[model samples]
Target: MASILMLTAATRRERNDATSFVFDAINACGGWIEDVHMYSNKMTTVRLALPGTAIEDLIGSLIDGGIAVDPPEAPASSDDRERRVTLQLTFLHDEPDLMRDIPAIPG
Candidate 1:
């Protein structure tokens, strides 16, 4: 299913890494990015509609890229049925591996 990722960059130190992760991960995820978004805090939120159910490769890519991921969170309400996962993350741009990924926000 298609979903949105609210990747909170949190601090300046995380921007480059997070940005790199976003770019790489989106590419690895097969160009599913419908929209690319950013905030004053250096946070980037992506709207993606992946073609497959297997997110492991994508997740792994992010992790390997030096991104730290939080456990996936379940949607909070019936109104949120469209969104199944939320990931909290912190990534290191220099590493560039999926294992270094962090998951944040409503996916």
Candidate 2:
């Protein structure tokens, strides 16, 4: 059975680069991307379908590549059926100065 894998990642790299990096990792681990959504230049979410057996390898690859991946939750049931796995990756970056150009308020 094919399991659904949902991944959310935040990257500081350019959009194309971040996407490509994820694509490469998934392909290398014998998974295919079903869909991908780019929320912003720094955030991307991907849905993948692959054999349940390959899930560990895919997650390991992402972590080995310097992505901080959260562990997937165990399936609710013991039945051998398709399940949904969710993993989240967060990349830390310095917060931008929102008021850099704003003039100081009068005291």
Identify the leading candidate in terms of lDDT.
2
Superposed Cα deviation of residue 56, candidate 2 (Å):
0.6
> Per-residue lDDT for 90 in model 1?
38
Q: Write the per-residue lDDT of candidate 1 for residues 1-107, one digit (tens) a residue.
A: 44443333232346765676666776665545566555443345566544344355556666666565543333222232233223334333353443434678796
Q: What lDDT score is found at residue 34 in candidate 2?
A: 71
Candidate 2, residue 69: the lDDT equals 67
**Residue by residue across 1-107, what tens digits does model 2's lDDT show?**
43454554455554465567778987786667776655434456677655566667776777676676655545333433444554444445565422335688999
lDDT of 2: 0.58
Query: Relative to the unseen true structure, what is the C-alpha lDDT of residue 24 in candidate 2, on a scale of 0 to 100?
Result: 92
Worst 10 residues of 1 by lDDT: 75-84
lDDT of each: 0.48, 0.58
